[model samples]
Every structure is written in structure tokens, then in C-alpha cells.
Target: MRFVLKHPEQADVEKIESLDSVKGTFTQAGQFQVIIGNDVDLFYNDFADVSGIEGTSKETVKDLAKSNQNALQRLMSNLAEIFSPLIPALITGGLILGFRNILEGVQIQMLGQKIVDGALAFTQNGAPIYNTIVDVSQFWSGVNHFLWLIGEAIFHFLPVGITWSITRKMGTTQILGIVLGITLVSPQLMNAYGVAGAESINTWNFGFAEVQMIGYQAQVLPAMMAGFVLVYLERFFKKVIPNAVSMVFVPLLSIIPAVLVAHVILGPIGWTIGAWISDVVYAGLTSQLRVLFAAIFGFFYSPLVITGLHHMTNAIDLQLTADFGGTLLWPMIAFSNIAQGSAVLGIYLLHRGDKKEEQVSIPAIISAYLGVTEPAMFGINMKYRYPFIAAMIGSSIAAVVSVGLGLMANSIGVGGLPGFLSFNADRWLLFGLIALIAMVVPATLTYMYGKRVEGNE
Candidate 1:
């Protein structure tokens, strides 16, 4: 008997293998293969296939089970494992960033116009630079300010959202976690970004110690770790606290101290780490060695996405944009995304004669181009290695050109065609040229020389 179990647990595999009749075992795409000389009974349900007798005809069922059971679990277990939980927040944040980019562009255009007008007046009137400007409010009207605020709010409270997601994953009380998260990013707390200058002056006396009330707005690591720590605290409290008073004391004691510790310690430490990374990435990528830097990043960025380490780049991107006028590294990411999608499209072209292969490649191609590369990466490119290499070459070329042209986005997160909205208006044409190159190069190379394989199914 040869059977494939759809959702294979280690326990189930062990049990099947323990049987005297079992001869061999293998696993792939969420399937566990058990080969025996004769029919053997297995406790587990959802047999994907038994000697090519499929469980169902639906691809969705197969794909969903495969992704949940195989890809993520087989990868790294720490930060990478949490990428699944973080997906909703990531997609939402990326979409909302488009609005932020638009508002930023409007502000830049208005400020540039005002400065030019002020300069002309100054030249004629012989006034100082400071005295030349008539009104600062004219640069950003009330509506613009409100729209900008709306755009910033999502990113500003991202820590809260991440904390909420993490706590849910860790089996902590969602409301308590939310409360702790919100308190960390509260409007009452001093902004973390502004804390450096205020470190000398800002002080709060809490009887036990005098500490600064720094907020954790936009912090990623601290929020995620804090949520994980809350689980143990809640579990400890459940054992000690009296049932009648447990509700009030457990929540108060568990969250208040955690929040305080996070604010005083974790928040600042995460901020420093984020800042250091931003400095390194920005300085390194913008240096005279930029062409080499671009090529290296473009080559490795897609692989980083596969391991789920790309989330680390978000902090660097956010901080770099805040410190510099705009971000220079994000264009490399966009180019890499375009290249990955183009390679998938090339695979689709090569396999057009096979309906099954085309079916697999088309959706993966669409997803890659839309700035979500996992489908294409895991589903198609990883299966046939040469397409991935072709994509890296394309990404490298595009990244070098982008860096040479000094292309940048006002914000991070957006990529692919949607990324055009995030480009600096002055460099829009250069951005387009780079994206086009990224797309065409990989497609051409993959079609000409990259290895092609039939559908994995």
C-alpha cells in the first residue's frame, strides 16, 4: 500500500512507520508517503492521495495545506515563523502607504514652489533668506495637514497592531495586550523619535525611579517581544492570584509592569538597533561602492524574502526615510520584485503548451508583479532554479541603474506597479526606466537560457 497523508503530523508519521508492515516513508508538499507491502490502517484523516488516487480535485485545498504545513514550518522558527501572523498587518500597511506618498509629494511640490518664489523675491528685494518667506502655513494648508495626519496614523500605530497580532498568536488575552500596546504608543507618552534631544530634560518620577516616558510608536521588535512576554506573565498570575480578585489584579499587575519595562528598556534598545541598521544600510548603499552594494542587495533580497528576514528591512527603510530626505534602498527592492515577476512570466511563456504548468505559473506571475513574491518564489522559481538566478541578474542591473540615477521613494512598503506612486516626482521617468529594465531583462534571459520544468503537481 502506498498512501499520501495530506496533513502529516510527526506523531502520525511515527505511528504509521511503527507499523510492522510499513516499508518506507517520504514527505513533500504537506504529504507523507507510506509504502507497505500490503494495506495498512492509519488513524489520520485527509489522505491527499493513495497510489495516485487523489483526495479531491480542488487545487485550492492542496495549495492551502501545502503552504501551511510545508513551506513555513520547514523554514526558520523564530521571527520567520511569525510572518504568517503578520501578513494582514503588512498588506494593510503597504496599501495605506500610498496615501502617505501622495501627501508627501504634495508637500514637496508646494514647498519647492514656495522656496522658488521666495528666492525670486529675495533676489529683487535684497532680503535675508529667513525674511523672504511671507507665510509658512501657505506651504501646507489645513486639508493637506489633515490628509497627511490620516496617512501617518496607520504607520504611527503599527506597533499596536503588531502587538495585537502577536498576543493573539501567543494565546494571551487580546484586550490586555491591546491595552498594553496602546499605552506604549499613547499620545500622552513622549515620542520615541524625539526622545534623544529630550533625554537630558525629560523626566518622570515614579517613586521607585525617575524615568523618561518614551513612547513606542512605529516600533516593531519591542512590540512583538513584549506581546510574547505577556503570555508567561498571564500564565504565572493564573496560578497565584485568587479567583475572585484574579480578574482585576492579574490584568493590572501583568500589563502595567510589562508596559513600564518595555517603555524603559525594550523600546529604546529596539530604537537604537533600528537606528544603527538604518545608518549602516543608508551609508553603505549610498557610498562610492553603491553599484556593488546594489548588485549584492538585489541578488540577496529575494532570498531574504523566502526566509522571511525581509521584515528586518522595514525598520531600516522607515528610519532611513525619516533621517534622509527620502529612502534610496527601496528602489532596489522594487526592482527585485519586478525581476522576480518577469522570470515567472518567462516560465509561463516556456510552458504555454502545458495547461497544468501554465495554470501554476500564471497566478504566481500575477502575485509576484503585485509585490507579493512568495507564490512565485516557492511555487515556481524554487522548483526550477534557473529562473530565480535569471531574476537576480535582472534585479542587479536594474538596481545599479536606479542607484546611479539617484532614484528614491518618499516612503517604503509599496512595490511593483503600485510603487510608481511612491517615486519622487522628479525621478519618475528614471524609476520607470529601471522597472522596465528589471522586467524585460529577466523575461528575456529566462526564456532564452533558464531551465524550465513541468508543473510540480
Candidate 2:
């Protein structure tokens, strides 16, 4: 307000045609004027440059001037849009990771973790660094931990939180955010096991479930429930309150009330959702109908990877670590993607191109091998279409076969060479071999097929 009033004269006045402003008197040589529309025309000769402001208010200026309010408003608007999807993504990943951490003990056991005592002695230096690194990693790993917490808090606790910010109907994505974030962060909670006797030396503790299932509620469910309120709050406030005012007011009023509801109600709801999804997927993947089931999962899975929905699998893994003790999904994508990349790239290898085509093919193939889909997708698979179909067919074959092998993943992260982690040597080796086989087949096929198209002889 002060900024607008102090420099009113310096701003060149614009005379946009007056609206029905009989009461609001224009006393001067109409020293100032206001126009409300897409474009403002300054009648005065003094007006030389065009300027814009963000907020709508009646401030008289001698010349058109860009106002800080407008800049700040635009910045806030841009940030909001950028963060909307990101908030959900962050929460879903964080919660799932939290859950995965909690269930690591059971997960480690299910994968038959061993050799910890034999691998290396956890003496003072080793012990401290190991613990410190793990803890520090957790802190840095989920910088979005708090953000997702906000995401969750709004979704589960504040109906207004969810409705105010977003208009879209809540569905798998919304639920998945709660599901995944719970999966990750829930696993991080304190899990203490009650040993049977004083001399039970082998008992281990998990972060969330301390030797029991009921305790999963204590740590994992709060954030899960928090997901609902935020979703609601988003819709409610977004309409009634201006974004600037809502920024401060939303957190203060929304957070406290939503948090209260979380502790009281939403925890069990989230747990149920997480458990149900995991159960259904595991049941499908493990059935005697594995081939059909796997092909279906495989077909959609890579598409998800292509679009980034594959992050849901990350949530599933976190839940896996917590509920059933391990994960087997995503490892297939590692093979399929690599295979697609290799096969498509084989075109470049077999190419006797006009240099330019070969150049394009080589880079596309390399990017695919590196597990980036765009160069392969937008570059080759998309351009030729056949290569993509070939890659998909190859991926499905590999996926079904991987399922048949009962391949499971104990290690985390997306598909790449590093995904070969020997943490569970038997499963790792079996899956690794299977993945290698899968990739080789498709790559060979693409290479052979691509040979005809290249060099035009």
C-alpha cells in the first residue's frame, strides 16, 4: 500500500474507459485513470512503456509500472502449480520408504539375510559410522518427508485440504500417495520386540513393528490418515481464500485440526488400504496363473515406467518390506527396459547408415541401454513403432519368465546395472541371469530386424 501511494506521480497515468463509477469521483484533470481488461491504453502522451502488476487494487500511478505485488503473486502461482503434483509424489514415495525401512528386519529375514556377524565386525569405528550413515541418510533421503507429511495431513485429516487445492476426484493416485508414503516412512518407526526370555540373544528390532503387528498402527498410520485432510483442504481454501492469505492461514488452521483427526481416526483406514493393495498384487503375481498375470502386470508396468507411475511399485516394495517381508516387483522392468534399449540399439550396431541415421540410432540405443526411455521411445521405438512393439513383446516374455523363476528383489532403486545387487545372492543371481537372457533376446531380434531398414543399400 505504501509502495503504491508514495510513487503515484512517477507512474504514467493510463485512461482506460471508465466503468459505472458515479460514486467514485474522478476529481482531477483525471491525473490518473484505471482500465480493466486484457490491455490497458494510456491516453496521455507521457505514457511510453507498457507495464503490468500482479494484484488487483485501485492504485493511481503516473506511468504504467510493474508492481512487486504482481511479481510476488506470479511467483507464488507458479510455485503452487509446480508443487501440486510433486507434493503427492513426494508423500507417496516418502511414506513407502518409511514403511520399507521399518520392515527391513523382517524383509531381510524373508530374503534370508545372513553373514552380517561374519561379514565384518561392527567395532567402535564401524558401528558408529554405520549407524550414523544410516540415520543421516534417512534425513537427507526424504527431504520431502516433511512435504509429504503436509500432503498426507491435508488429504486425510482436512476434507477442505483435499477439496480446496485440487478438483480432481480422488482415486488410485490419491490413495497411492498415502499408501506409498506409509509404506516408506511407516517402516521407519520404532519396532521393539519382546524377547521370550532374558537370554534370547538373537531377537532383532524393526523400526516400526517391534515384534508385533498391532504396533504398525502406532507409527505408520498417522501419516497415511493425514493424506485425506490435505486433499480436502486444497479444494476448500483454493476457492474461498486468495492464495497469498491462504498460504499462512492454511497451514495454521488446517494443520492443527487435521493432525488431531489423524491421531484419532485415519490411521486404521490407511493401514487397511495398504494391506489390501499389497495382498491383491501379491496374490495375482504368485498364482498358478502366473503367466497371464505376469503378462498383464508386465504390459502395464513398463507403460507405468514410461509415464513415471512406476513409483507406485516403490511404494509396494516399502509395504512389502513391512507386511509380507520382501518385494519382487520392479526387477522385471530392469530386464525389460534394458532389453528394449539393447534390442533397439542393436539397430545402430548393425547399421551401415548414412552417418546421420547411424548417429541418431547410436545415441538412442545408448540412452535406452542406460534405462532412459525418451531417446528410445521418442527417437526409435516411436519412430519405427515396430521396435517398440518388439521391445514390449520381448519384455512380456521376460516378465512372465521372471515370474516363473519366482524372482524377487531385495535391493532397492530403478532398473539399471546396479540393480544386480548381490544382497540376496541366489535370488539376485537367478533374476540377474534371467534379466540378461531377457535383454539379449529382444536386442538380437531388433538388431536383425533393423538391419533391413538401415543403409538402404
Query: Per-residue lDDT of 270-306 in model 2, one digit per residue for the tens?
Result: 6678778778878877888877887877666655644
lDDT of 1: 0.68
Question: What overall lDDT goes with each candidate model?
Answer: 0.68, 0.49
| Total backbone collisions for each predicted model | 0, 67
Worst 10 residues of 2 by lDDT: 21-30
Estimate the TM-score for candidate 1: 0.73
Pick the TM-score winner. 1
**What would the TM-scores of all predictions be?**
0.73, 0.52
What is the clash tally of candidate 2? 67
Report each candidate's C-alpha RMSD, comma-separated, in the order given: 8.6, 17.3
Give the deviation of candidate 2 from the true structure as CA RMSD: 17.3
The residue-level lDDT of candidate 1 at 255 comes to: 91
| lDDT score, candidate 1, position 453 | 36
Per-residue lDDT over 350-386 for candidate 1, one digit per residue giving the tens place of the 0 to 100 score:
7678655565577777777778776577656766788
